[model samples]
Every structure is written in structure tokens, then in C-alpha cells.
Target: MSDATLAIEPSGPKPKPIFSRRNIIVYGSLIVICLYYLVPLYVMVVTSLKGMPEIRLGNIFSPPLEITFQPWVKAWAEACTGLNCDGLSRGFWNSVRILIPSVIVSIIIASVNGYALANWRFKGANIFFTILIFGSFIPYQVMLYPIVIILREIGLYGSLTGLVIVHTIFGMPILTLLFRNYFTSVPEELFKAARIDGAGFWGIYFRIMLPMSLPIFVVAMILQVTGIWNDFLFGVVYTKPDTYPMTVQLNNIVNSVQGVKEYNVNMAATIITGLVPLTVYFISGKLFVRGIAAGAVKG
Candidate 1:
């Protein structure tokens, strides 16, 4: 055989360079996006540290001459929401009250639904999943009115239970999709082996699936915590003023147009409201990345 023919005989076309100009363009765009996203956070930090006098000087980029924790203290203990002088501390607790049970219930329901859809060939499963996937695409605002009426009819309106249920209902479609995709990525043979070993559905799920799903669970937790913590509209509309989440109180403080706007306190309250989700993101960011990567590969 000729050398040229022999050389060309087999393995398909050679691959292109990994670090081509297109790759550089993509990475450069990402860096720009990351900086764009982080700029607000930088502003918030600087603003939070500054006093009202410095803030009015209108140099948003400048550092504070006298950095003080006074704003933070005020935001934590004494910032006003309407006539109420109590700061965001009360709202923070209200958020926790709504967040914990909502996260737990949502995750449990999503996981079970995901497992069932992935493993079982029950009737109408595909139709149900399609509806769920479609449901995720609908804007949540479109459902708010109906949900409000339903909650009122059920006598859960203006209560923590109402807010928790709202979060779970709104969160379910995405969470179910995440877990279902993750479960689909898992090995079918493992499930079959468990079945052959006389394991029942719940037995196999709890024994084999749930443990394997911890990374995805962590991812789910991160998503739900951030969403629930930062929630403002639902908190305002569904909850009583006394039960408002920190975001609502923060908004009221920042947007109150009548009084002398204490920019420092506004910034402080904004940061305080954001701190929980920010902390969760910072602490679990690595785990979040790992979990998402693992889940994506399997999904």
C-alpha cells in the first residue's frame, strides 16, 4: 500500500486546536460578564462602609475616610420600616421561618418525583413530565393571582404557611427537572441490580439513589436558599407586614421617599438583607460548582 493511502486510511479528520481564537473570545467575554456582575457587589460594599456625609459627596467609587460599623449596627437593630423602629433582625427571623420548612418539603417532593419519573414506566409518566417541563417555562407572575386566590380560599393567606407553600410550589418545577436529569445520569444497572436483590422501590431509592444524590441535593439547597432568601415580591404580597421577610423591609427602608434618605442606612440595610445568600454562596461556591459539574455529567 502507498504511504499516503496508509496514513490517511483510518481515524477520521484530525481535531482542531483546543485554544483557538474562538476559545479566547469565549473566555474573554466570560471575564467581562463576571466583572459586570461583580461591580454591584463592589458598590454595595463601599456604600455600606461609608457614612451618609460621604455618600452625599457622590463619589460612589471613593473609599470612606471613616469606616464605621455604625450603619451595620443600625441596620441590624434600629432601622425603621414604617412606624416600626425595629431593624431587619425581625424580618431575618421571619425569612428563616419561611425558608427552612419550604426547602425541606420542596427537596423531598422533587427528589421522590424525579426518582419515580426516572425509574418507573408507569402510565402517563412522559405526559406528566412534559407538563412539568412546560410549567417551568411559564413566568411565575402569571400564576400569582390564581395562587393568591387559592391560598385565600384555603385560609392560608397572609400566613407563614402560605409563603412556604408558595415557595415550594413555585420552586417545584425546576427542582424536579434538576433531580430527574441527575437521576437519569445514574447507572440503570445499579437500579436493576437492587431490584434483582429483592429491593422494593423505596428501598432502592433510599438505599442507593439518595446517598448518591448528595451533590445534587447540595446544589438544590443552594438554589432554594438563594431564591427564598432574596425573595421580595412574594414576601410582600403573600405575607402580612408583621411577617415580612428582610427583603421587604429592606425595600421599604430604601424606597421610602418622604423622609431624609439616609443613604448609609439604606446601603447598610441592603447589604444586611443580601448577606445571608451571599454568605451561603461564598461558603458553598466550590461545592456548588462541583455538584453542578457532577450532576451535569450524569444528567
Candidate 2:
């Protein structure tokens, strides 16, 4: 072949640059969406760092030109809510209490129920499971009175125990769904072999399934921690003032009408109240993806 003919022409077209027109558009759109989500948090931090005077004068989106931690201190210890000016600490601890018991009990109940539903398969079990799943779709507003009556009859209507039970009951459906999906994804041969080896229900769960399901369990813990920590309506409705969760008390602090609204303190309290769930999310983020994938390949 002639030298000119042997020379290669470039392929069909030039490759688009990573930062080319399409990519810039795509990435620019994503960046805008991210900024949209982050703006509130940035505003929260900025407001928390500013004084009431600065807050009133400057825009919420402005960074604090004069950063002060008084808001944080007040939010944690000095801010008032009606007769109790002890600040958000009490509510924070109360939430911790509510969070721990609620998570443990909810997880235990959900796991047992999930194990039964996935493996046991009794005649009416599916019917009950269907009802329970449907119950999850019901608005809390609709069931609020029935739940209140039930708690009242049990003498737990306004107690922490009652509140914990309320968390457990409401939390059951999702957690059960999570565990059931995870468990169902497990190999049937393992379960059958365990049964053949004379492992009972509890035995199989503890010995065979538990170790293999830690990712899903972490995911469940993440869900429960976030839900129970951030819960306001249930905490307010199910418990009395003394047992109020952080969310309820935070609302009380910000809007209790006993004093002029301190925007800085309100913002600080909001950040403090949000920290637990945020912490859980940051810590368990990597495992969260795995947890969500628990049953997908199997199903």
C-alpha cells in the first residue's frame, strides 16, 4: 500500500472530554442539587454561630462575620422552655434513653417476627403478616387514637415505657420487612441442613443466620437510631412533658411562646437535635449500601 494509504485516519469521532458539554451539564445539575440540599445545613451552622442582632441584620445564608459559641452553650444548657430552663441537655438524655430501649426492643421483636415469617410459614401467618404490612401504610393520625386508648388501658399512655412500646410497635413493620428480606436471601440449604442437624427455630437463628446477617442488622440499627432519635410526634403524643424526647423538647424550646424567639439558639438546638441521626448516617454510610442490597440478588 502507498504510504498515504497506510496512514490511519482517526476513528469516527473525537472522544468527548470528561468536562465537555454533556458532562458539564450533568455535573452542573448534580452540583446544584447538592448545594440545594446543603444550603439548609449551611444556613443552620451560620445562624447558630451568629448573634440575634446579626441574625436580624444579616441574611441567613451569610457566614458569621463575628462567630460566637454562645448559641451552642445556650442551646446545650441555658435556653428555656416554659418553667424548665435547663436547656436541651435533659431532652438530649431523655432521647438517649428512649433511643436505646426503643431500638433494642424493636430490633428483637422484628428479628423474631421476621424469622418466623420467612421460615415458619404457618397457615394464618401470611394473613397476619399481610395485615401487619398494610398497617404500616396507615397514617399515624388514623391510628393515633386507637394507640392512645390501648396505651391508656395498659397504664402506659404517658410513660417512657409506653413511649418505648409505641416506638417498637410502629417500628416493627419496616424492621421486619428488612430482616425478612435479608433472611429470605439466605440459602435454603443452610437452613435445611441446620434443621436436619436438629437445630430449632431459635437455634437456627442464633447460630446460622445471625452471623451472616450483620450488614442487615447494622442497616436496621441505623434505621431505628435515626427514626427513634428524630421522632417528635410519637414522643409528644405518647409521653408526658417529663419524658419528652429531644425533638419534642426542641420544639418546646424554639416555639414555646414564653419569650422572644432567639433564632441563634433555635438554630443551635436544631443542629444539636439533628446530630445523633447525622452521626449514625456518617458512621454507617458504607455499610448502608450493603444492607439495602440484602435481598435484591435473591429476589
Candidate 3:
């Protein structure tokens, strides 16, 4: 009688193996991709630490037996870029000057455009957005000459101010699209409530949209910083030798034909040039992911 009263247990799904075929394939691909990128980075770091003799004799993959920061110091302070013997210091400052205003002005204008398009519902909004989206797809190479002329007409050519304006304009379309998509994801109720509570455009933007928009802003910042910082085309074309940005200076340093190739110095300079964007991404990586996911959901 007691045995007959016993309940039957339910069998749950079997645990998947850690080394299952799917897991192995996915993890293997990831490992390969990571190594593909990390190996070069490893080589760069190691080579940057090695002296010229060690770098010449040793395999690039090998660790530095005698670590020295001479290459890094040279790359940062003493490397020649065309007629200028001053390393990347001037270019670095130029880049900073270009980056700050470009990022700020672009983000502010784009965010406002996005907010208006998403919530304000003005006439011709769709047409305006379509044109902007269209602009994003237009190759920068195609517009380079046009921009040069425009800058020249306004007398901004070869100036850091001109570069800043170029970056701001180029960045606007994509950044506006990102911000618009993100703002569109915000609940209509919140926007309406803010409006009823006497919040105007700027008020809602400052009080409501912005606080909840840290992720997207981080995403925008990362995108703009990376693009502007690494841009060689614009930096080279729009500015003269003296106003060259870090990327342009880096190109000159790496490609200079006047002396023996300083491989260690070149590698160090490359890494140094890349560090700003890398640091920015690493710090705000989580927010970037969150923003991307949020944007993906609805737009």
C-alpha cells in the first residue's frame, strides 16, 4: 500500500557536455579571432620594448630579453615626421583639438536632431531623415573634393578648425541616426507625461532623455572618437603638414624614407596612436554593448 502511494519523479533534460561539437566550434572560432588580433598586439608590445639590436635578431613573437622603453620614448618625443623632427606630440595635440570639438558639436547637434525627429513630429521630418540616412551611405571619398572647396571658400582649409568642422559634418548623419533610433525606443508615455508637466524640448531632453541615455551617448562617443582619431584621409587631405593629426604624423613616421627603418619605433608609435580609442572602448565597453542591444531591439 505504501509503495503504491509513492509519486513518480520527473526527469529533467540531460546536461550538455562542456566540449560539445557546437561549443567547440563556437569557442574555437572565437579563440582564432582573438588570437588573430591579440597576436599582432603582442608582437607590437614586445617589439616596442626591445632595443634595435634585439629586435633585429629576435623573432617578433619572442618576449624582450632586455626590456627597454627607448622605442616608445623615441616614438613619442623624437621621431621625424616629414620636415618636423618633433615626434607625435604636436600631432597628438592637434588630434585632441580636433577630437573634442568634433565629438561635442556633432553629438549635441545629432542628439537634438534625433530628439526632434523622434518626439517633436515636425512636418518634413521623414524627408529630412531620409536625406540624412542617405548621406551616411555616401562615400567620404566622393565628397572629399566638395568639402575641400567648401572649406576653402570659407577660408578654413588646412586649419584644425576646418578639420573639426569636417568631422562634425561627417559624423552627424550616422550619429543622428543612432540617437534617433535610441530615442524612438523610449516609451511614448514618458515623453507625453513630460510634455503635460510643462517640459519643453530642451527640458525633456535635459531632464528625461539624457539621464536615461548614458549607454547610447557612450556608444556615440566611442564611435566618434575611434573614427576621428584613426582617420588618415581627412587629416591628410584637409590639413597641412604643420596641422597634421596623429594618424597623419604616424603615417609620416612609419613611411619616412630618410633613415633606416626603425621597426620598434614604428610599432611603438602605432600602439601609442591606438591607445586613446582602445582605452575609451575598454572603459565604456559595457555601456556600448547595452546601447547596441537597446538600439537593435526596435530600430
Query: What is the lDDT for 207 in model 2?
Result: 94
List TM-score per model, in order. Answer: 0.86, 0.92, 0.93
lDDT of 2 by residue, 29-136 (tens): 999999999999999999999988999896987789899999999999988776778899989999998889999999988998888888888889889889889978
Per-candidate local distance difference test: 0.88, 0.88, 0.93
Best by TM-score: 3
TM-score winner, 2 or 3: 3
| Cα error, candidate 2, residue 181 (Å) | 1.3
Per-residue C-alpha lDDT of model 1 across residues 217-252, encoded as one tens digit per residue: 989999999999989889998998899988898888
What's the lDDT for candidate 2? 0.88
Best by lDDT: 3
Query: lDDT tens string, model 3, 188-264?
Result: 88899999999998999999999989889989999999999999999999999999999999999999888799999
Q: In each prediction, how many residue pairs overlap at the backbone (N, C-alpha, C within less than 3 A)?
A: 1, 0, 0
**Runs in model 1 with CA error above 4 Å?**
1-35, 295-299
Q: Candidate 1, residue 293: CA error in Å?
A: 2.0
Q: Which stretches of candidate 3 lie over 4 Å from their true place?
A: 1-13, 295-299
